[model samples]
Target: MKHFYKAMIGLDLTEMDDILIKKTIVYLDFLGIEKCYFVHVAKDLAVPDEILRNHPELLAPGDESIEALIKNKLREFDFPASMDIEVSAEEGSHPLDTFLRWAKIKDVDLIIMGRKEELAGTGSLAKGVATKAPCSVLLLQEKRPPGLPKKIMIPSDFSDHTDLIYDFGERISKEMGAELVPVHLYEVPQGYSKTGKTFEEFSEIMKKNAQDDFNRFIQKFNHNGLTCRFILNDGEGQGKALLEEAKLIEADMILLGSRGRTKSAAILLGSVAEKVVLANNILPMLIFKKKGETMGFFEALFKV
Candidate 1:
């Protein structure tokens, strides 16, 4: 199905956070829809139990503090309320599980979440969800401060999932019409950058490779049909490199496949993809998940 109402459920509340929320609000507003839900799940036990017991109080007069606070947040964005504001509280050990459950129950077409840091490996949240979740995820990432969209940076490694954008990025990018910046960032070649910044020595080769990848993808489509800018970097983190390139190009958004190479190595790798989603800049983002590579045998049978 298609996602009509947009919702976000994270609260590290920063400039980058605001940017993503703001962008969602803008899109919903433009669509002339008012029933969007922006859920702020209180994962911690800090909220008093007394308040939890009186769950109805969220909408009660004088008890409307939280409700108003949430509405005020929406109002701040110039988005109108079409559906009654609903606040839910639940006790759960893992925030990801709680969110996934809620998303399933609500039949949410899109799930928006923010990451505080972009750590790699088994600990990443963004990577985890994008890989396993039942719905499409929009990870609002801000590397730089909130800014206008002069570019839209897409980080890819030519993997099946990342390049399998005929549906995800293609549909969204058409609506955005911002510069489709396709970036390929590689780690420095083993022998080079032995001591200093890894990008120092291998930058040129990476740039050339980026150009080749750009041409290859372009050839897959009609030339001069879509406007875009190409870039490359040899660096430590692909996420960080994408953010820097976003700022350099004054990008308005970032589109990427949620997890990286190790998507199936463990649980959802939403956290792995979190690096790009948690930027300080207010750029909107869309994260897609390609469950697995199409097996050659399966492809041949299907073609038959």
Candidate 2:
């Protein structure tokens, strides 16, 4: 079974850290995760000379203090004894760069981070990690409770990458005893009326075409006799349509594949994935990616 082995959780030393830790514990067994790295990055670890002179008791480095606090927080929870857990507090002006570096160094297979809605920090870190990380990323909604998903919604385009997305969805569903809901969004052409068809007629045609494609695509995968629901969306925006369907189905999580860009490209995630990440603030989303698929590009882009 394809499963995540090592996961890195980004901590900000806020209340969100507790939620993320609890969520990680809930998913460790389901994802088959063997190791975890709880990492916190500070903009600067240097203390001002003036402040240090006044407070001579503050002799320890900032990283040490931050690391100790994180360790104490972890002690509050009861993690599995068999899992290898590591805590790191590092100084980096650009946190996304630091996270990517650590993920590569640790050979991490998954990166889990909190997506703030009414929380303190903006969700840019989670978006950036989802866009550029070499491995998969799970963006947990701060407002949502952490637990096993009952139904995972996957947005499929019937591309070659859909196979990879379905593989992950199937593995997670089977292990966690959840249902798989695959959604396909189709759009009617701008000049559908030119084909002597009404707008409504053209819409139905598009939906039927999408259903045909989905039937063929799903024929190749073994769903383990699970009840898989197929949905068709013909809305204006693919990302928005997918989210609406997720809400209609009361999905617990949204899982989708990301066709990452090369080093020369301006963006990493495709347009729809990026849009969904930006607008979504309700459900936990897992962006699946082939591990180490972009290592060469990342090395060149970062000049490592």
Candidate 3:
């Protein structure tokens, strides 16, 4: 079964666009992506009057030039003839709004974009789309090597969210022949000694309890014959611990589940997911969201 049939890729006209497009092609088969929409949104597409006067040879409209440029960049890649590809260069005061609108209009199942690290970018656009897009978002780090992931790390709290995370992980693992490493971070309570146990003993007990919870959770899904790792938080935050574990295991991709936001909440993404998205600059991260789960909320929020 295909998880992502259609995807929208956000391009900033920076070098990152090359990385994003290349990675998308690499994972197109693994993701079961049949169609891709390459979209670039600028704050203002109109060329400045001074620059236009200085260079009268540039007569084409701003959007048309950008669209042509993107098309030319894509021509360098030999995409499958069966793939449906389209490019759009648009103007919007807020690029995020334009991205979300185009994503909804196209009914994309996933949004692919890049996260800047060594590159000269704040990565705010990637974060905004990951948090607010109606579909799942794949963030490719600017410095990371572009290819299919060998090991996919998933952080599980053993909640309903874990189910979603595992579902995606298993699908990707099966399709791409990657290994699934489910990681669960457990913490001992501050007052564990009150239970008449030493800190070390309590830590072991907490670990055991986490293992038990994981076993129960895993029973619900097939998991493609994989195991879950139980780690002690050791005072660090969950987000930090997750990244550390990903490094220790040499995971190339991090799969996370976003609980999304309610109508009253100010933020759309959960705090842990946001932290991971911001701090992670080495690994490609896939922030999965159940399609249409928050469509009503987004439509109202964006006034669609």
CA lDDT scores, all candidates in order: 0.52, 0.78, 0.81
Give per-residue CA lDDT, model 3, range 1-304, as digits (tens).
4789999999987788888778788888878899999998889887657646755665788977767767777887765668899989888898898889899899899999998888788888898888778888999888787788899998777875667778777877887788999888888898887889998999999999888877777776655376888888888777788899999999999998776334333226677777778778779999888876757766787763
Tell me the deviation in Å of residue 163 in model 1: 4.3
Per-candidate TM-scores read: 0.62, 0.87, 0.88
Clashes (candidate 3): 0
Best by lDDT: 3
Q: State the TM-score for model 2.
A: 0.87
lDDT score of model 1?
0.52
Pick by lDDT: 1 or 3, better one: 3
Alpha-carbon shift of residue 125 in model 3 (angstroms) = 0.8
Model 3 ranges off by over 4 Å: 47-58, 80-82, 193-196, 222-224, 260-267
Superposed by TM-score, candidate 2 places the C-alpha of residue 30 at a distance from the truth, in angstroms, of 1.7
Positional deviation of residue 62's Cα in model 2 after best superposition, in angstroms: 0.7
The TM-score obtained by model 1 is 0.62
How many Å off is the CA of 65 in candidate 3? 1.1
